[model samples]
Target: MNTPPSPLEAERTDGSSVRIGALVPLTRPGWAEAGRHLLAGLELAVREVNDTGGIVGRPLELVVRDSAADPTRAAAAVDELARLGVAAVAGEYHSVVARAAAARADALGLPFLCSSAVLDALTEQPTDWVARLAPPQSRGWQLYADFLLGAGHGRIAVAADSSVYWATGTRILRDHLAPRGGTVIELDMRALTPAAVCDELVEQGATALLLLVGYPDPAVSVVKAVRRDQRLAEVLLGAPAGQPEFAEWAALLGDDGAAVPFLRYLPERLSPLGTRVEKALRERLAEAPSFVAFEGYDTIAVLADVLRSHGTDRARTAASWASVAVDGTRGQIRFSRTPGISVWQWAWPSIQVVDRDPAEPDRFRVLHAG
Candidate 1:
């Protein structure tokens, strides 16, 4: 794990208040809204914790910094959070940012609970200071592939962005299907226009497309291009989990987005508790609550429980993140280290396929359960 002693300059914890640093993309170019929603979730949990008299006898505090949705920027933010003397760090919407923050948090001997970052490698290795609330990409890809094959969409076309997370997912999906003799056409999203890629897929008799882009901007852009190509109307469109994180992807695409299905964290049927959480978040935010928001809320809730059990000692608190089991917004949350995936990861997390209404993209219906 290579966790070091807490730095001398790091904020000293004397139980006056338990501060947890939050890293989100508050000012990123395309991910500003994602940052806002993720932060809302963290704040929601913080308010709940403080309202209940906090941990032990100290009130809970969140020291927030913009991760900027970039790996380098997020790494620096993790250092800043450690220097601020937070007991632990949580909240990250982008996998790239989470990747850097996780490593840096480990080096600083600070506990970090990631809210949402599905890249396979973030938790692939053992890190004493890190535990993720999201599932590994390997699991997500398997779920996605199973859904596509079961739906009779075997000839797939993949459009992958240049980002590390997107590229890694595309590679993982490709490898997963190789043993089944599945045919996949791969295209570089950064190098080609969406229309051109659609045309190539059409020519190749591709029955489906998996958009492996990091942001909604590019994913929606490709959906628009594909929709305009009237000849490819029957092509089954699919996306990684990023598509459902932001409402704009569906709202902006309208009918086009509704036709495409994407991985989403919501269960197939909302339980009574889930309905209440949805109502609370809808009242809080103008748009519908995303899984990212719920993840942020759950991450802190789990950490607060761990803090109650382990006290404010950062090392002990960090080590206790793996055993967290709390029901916040979602059902019971837990973690395990898998042989192929990262250490202390939420394994086999279920995700559903979502298709939004053309007239009301804010509202969606789950078409498939994962």
Candidate 2:
């Protein structure tokens, strides 16, 4: 349960707080830590903005709502934020929730910038008021395919849960693999036990099994099943984000989780701002921040610029967001017109393949940069 937000006086006579709204899964399985990291990033951005004279000399505020990681609830959250008359809205880690929020933002003609959540279909047809900061899933899948095929692994078996994020990401990989001489034996993981999926992949001459299940339960099932099977030594395992994004994933698999490759956008080097952000996160949250946290901070920073330039004018902000390019934590932050990659998607994105060895469970090594 959440306490009601206390009304604050706007600096102007209008009595608005110059607020930005957030939709995040504050109370959902597999998302609590992620939500905390995102909220931390957002709060940091809000503080920084306010300290630096704020937007038009008014302190910025955030009105956050729990998304519960559901599409319908996410949409409702957007509607509620719209009713609050927020100048802009952002923050979401799940693609399903992002898709709903994006659509609702479009309907309301509110400026919305998604923090994280990458599915190509989210931006396949661009909306006037919505854009995403993360690269689309197709871009991530392309990096994964290039890495696998380049490493002499072509006979790959892909398995993903029925969730929209995993399904779209797996299909993108399947599409890319065929043209590159890599064969994909697809496994639709709908209630099928990990043992069943692994048996089929091993039988089909699969050299590697790619698990795109966003949540860890299904991923754990597949990995645990594979480790228990006698043939595990013969096949490699890969996952989106290179194992799970959390340390708990390492705690769960322990030794068996070693050497599994996954794509992650961690910069080969952290910028000065990145260093400060990480230090702040550790000081406040007592944990090292993930790439997701950087994303959240950058999104709010960009939106703060929009609100500063456009002054809460939705039409003006939406029109100017694409042209408002600034260097962010990873690299240059800009939208492009590249085909297949959405008009709003970032172009020239690169990701590193990372793995955690059983001997060094907490450390991740960069295997390849794609």
Candidate 3:
């Protein structure tokens, strides 16, 4: 088998590029589509930054590394990026991978701005080295639980794979739903087939089935199985992890993918700056961009701002997280210490419960907002 290409680097013969390490999942088993959108956003922002005037007249550059959704690989990338002397590091889609990167970055005194991972405990202990743009998992998932309750879904079934991310999501949902007179039925996807999940849902008399599993594989299969089951026609399908947000989900499942409500981070209305970025991102991505893409763009935007104001020193960049106030594609972005969360976090990003319209599979319909 051919070996994977080396980490991409900017070609600046004079070596004047101010590099930021980008940790993205560009290969399979890692959500490659999300990575593409994220990299597009990062590239767009970098181009825009260079177009006007790059950081103090030096061109901003991205050193790309594929995390491949592996925690060990991500940590190693952090070590390598640090050794390469990047000013800062950004981008990661998987929470577990981000957590490892965060720990390594903190230990190495490198600043890392996390783009999309939402695990509550990003690092075992709070440190100044890491900051995140994605709202914490508890905040987003709790809002999802509230949406389910408002939609009259008290009896919920979750088909989940065993992983810290999925398990954390399950705990958040259970904790949020239990006191609100809701019942959560857990289905272990590791042992149960899609058909078996359908059987379990019926037996448990669940009104909604939440997918706490990975995309395409069992998720697509589970959606197909549920959609085809005549007895489960009225049951609501959900993916709190935002599985249906990407174009691949639609391409594979078509109309069956529609109406499966999932969480998304976007405002009901975009600001003027946001509107412009959205159009540019759409053109760059050749499709309507997911929130993850905006997160990527915003990550660069924030970093550019910090680098310009604080210079390229890693310590200054890490210290500058408390003062970030960039206008992101979603809203005004700012980072702060939130309760129970270790990383400097964007206090909140706009949260919404949305689904693809059955009539127009490509169109999304917002069901609730938080």
Candidate 4:
């Protein structure tokens, strides 16, 4: 649960105000930490906007609803928020939840934006009221695949969490790797434990391992398992390990040469628009924040930009979602040919494997910054 908002939820009282609602995953399993981070980001955005004079002179007011990460619950929450007469709605990182929220937003003819859902399907689908703020998983995968192939690593083994998210990434990975003369040996296993699967990979004589798990807990487990044996340490850990959680895992593993190149957004290096976003995030989240906070801040940034540009009208805001181009934390963001339906595009982060240092117990260094 997040900190309770004050009684004065609305920022301005004199004239018409932009009342936007957000459907967030605040208590979902495997996403509580992310949810909290997102909520913090949203709060920072709201406070900053109100302090600086909200959209169009009237202050911005947000009505928040918790989705619990259930698609059905997410759908219900969207409908409830709509009934409250919100001009637009935004969602968090999970593509599944984004899809579910988009369905409801489309049905209601409401403007909706997703901050972190990156499944290609979200943009591929035909819709007039849905948009995404994160690059599709496919795009991320393509960037990852090209980097790995360019580095002279061809033969690869893939170990992915059976979760739907990882499965989507696997498909993208397979599509890209298969065409480049690289063979991916995919292992169907639980992401929770990597030791068991790593043992099997060693027996199978795999030279490089790709991890397709999204959460940090499973990622760490898998890395520890891979490094259990000296031979396995010499093999490559696949691209998914490039996520910030991998840094935490590397610190915990205390072993060298276990990380493989992977794809992710590089917030530090982006265009001018990207720089503006970075500034906003740093201002909002004064303390060190997680990736999830970036997702949340980006979500509000998109909505606020659209709302401010389109006169705070739901229909116009929907139109602005299609027309307005804003810089996301990752890269340039604009709706796909359709109106409310947009997806984020970004440069993927890639890193080279260097000898891991055992002296540090909490941080690991990679050759590249991704």
Give lDDT for model 4.
Answer: 0.64
Candidate 4: worst 10 consecutive residues by lDDT? 344-353
What are the lDDT scores of the predictions, listed in order? 0.77, 0.77, 0.92, 0.64
Q: How far off is residue 297 in model 1, in Å?
A: 0.7
lDDT of 3 by residue, 199-293 (tens): 99889999999998987799999999999999999999999889899999999999999999999999999888889999999999899999999
Candidate 4 — which pairs collide? 130-340, 130-341, 131-342, 132-342, 239-262, 264-349
Off by over 4 Å in 1: 1-15, 214-216, 269-273, 358-360
Give the candidates in order of lDDT, highest first: 3, 2, 1, 4
Model 3 TM-score, 2 decimals: 0.95
Q: How many clashes in candidate 4?
A: 6
Model 3, total clashes? 0
Evaluated at residue 225, the lDDT of candidate 4 is: 72
lDDT of 4 at 33: 53
TM-score of each: 0.90, 0.91, 0.95, 0.78
